[model samples]
Target: MRKRFLVLILLSLPLGSFSQDINFELDFSAVYWAPKSNDTIRISVGNNGRYIFTDSEEVAKSFGSITRRFQPAGGKENADLKLLFDLKTIFMLMEVKIGQNTVLANVDLNQFMKKGKSIDSATVRKMSATPTALKIENNGKKYKLYGVAPDNKPDDLIYMAFNEKYPVDYDTYFSKLMTSATGELFSIDIPSGLLVHVEDSKGEIILELLSIKKKKQKGSANIQLKLE
Candidate 1:
């Protein structure tokens, strides 16, 4: 029987200042496969990432009536607070509903390569070791970083892509929180910017991004995020 996989992706736009609050929409899909099982999970994000609604009746029941959102308990600093709050909350609930056996192990680069997966060994190692410190490279954008400020890239891709999309402190607070002695908040080493892909090195999960985009209702037309 072919083993099934799961993928988890976190994305957020830098906080942008518009004349008026705008309404944006998010579309997410998750595909699950087993020897005798094949199902597609679809989720719609509304209310500025505060509400997550599903089209599947069975899946909806699984999530329960409780809503998942970022209602920081106060004074508690988390690196992925704003960017991954909704998705993280949903995943935590899943671990409880689906049982621990279904939960994937911590991602390990060496173990993944041994399994015959093709990816940048050195780069993945760097990212896995120091996600905050390492940079993601793709589409002519080399060594892209997420931090208090942007790197020396003439195009300002990282900043322009996220700066106005999410809160400014999202990166600043996260960077500081991650470096604290208390330790990292997220289990995975995620670099900054709008993440479009993820590889669960443990082989338990293999999530792919179907589509991720942002639409402006009314605001200054600016550069949008592009991940290829």
Candidate 2:
């Protein structure tokens, strides 16, 4: 999945008047039971609003909970969850803009394992690195999300969507987030775990809600949103 959705309501009160940073975490567990083997994929949110999407295949037989903590990459302010979690960009880009098309907040994720070639001279390697960034001039009316490959390599078009501008409201969003009619894109908006399930010849994948934790800051917010 190259692209992805938006806000899961960090605040109950409308965000039009208030501007501050808040941290939230959405936990989910995925599993597939094939008679021969079991597979699992897990996804979660970060305190700074990064979504961690990881995929694992063929486990021995344990479904114990796991939280994979990763330190920020060297010289990189925000750790690439795409790299740390399952080594693929399995999450999509999401955002919430407030007054005057100003981006209030955003979340991002994508599909893993879409590799780009690397030239080391000594050896060639297959590496997948797509940095997600989305921009909208008219505040969610229309969006263009692009996946920029690291090291000035090739880039991929994640998602370009259109919607008539609607005034901000809880009902206006949060029921369902859709990127494209086809399920090529993936998005993780909390509680939306309700609508997330996958089944194919390889068994089934489920997102089970575990917990949600949130904290708000009163002063200036240093929210490092991924999308523009």
TM-score of each: 0.26, 0.21
Per-residue lDDT of 42-160 in model 2, one digit per residue for the tens?
33333222333332322211311111111123322221221122112222322322122222222222111222122224322221223235433332233332231212233322222
Model 2 poorest ten-residue lDDT run? 63-72
Q: How far does residue 137 in candidate 2 sit from its true spot (Å)? A: 49
| Top candidate, metric lDDT | 1
Runs in model 1 with CA error above 4 Å?
1-37, 46-51, 61-189, 193-195, 202-204, 213-228
Error of 2 at 121 (Å): 49
The superposed Cα distance between candidate 1 and the true structure at residue 180, in angstroms, equals: 19
lDDT of each: 0.28, 0.26
Best candidate according to TM-score: 1
Clashes of each: 14, 7
lDDT for model 2, on a 0 to 1 scale?
Answer: 0.26
When summed lDDT is taken over every stretch of 10 residues in candidate 1, the lowest stretch is 92-101
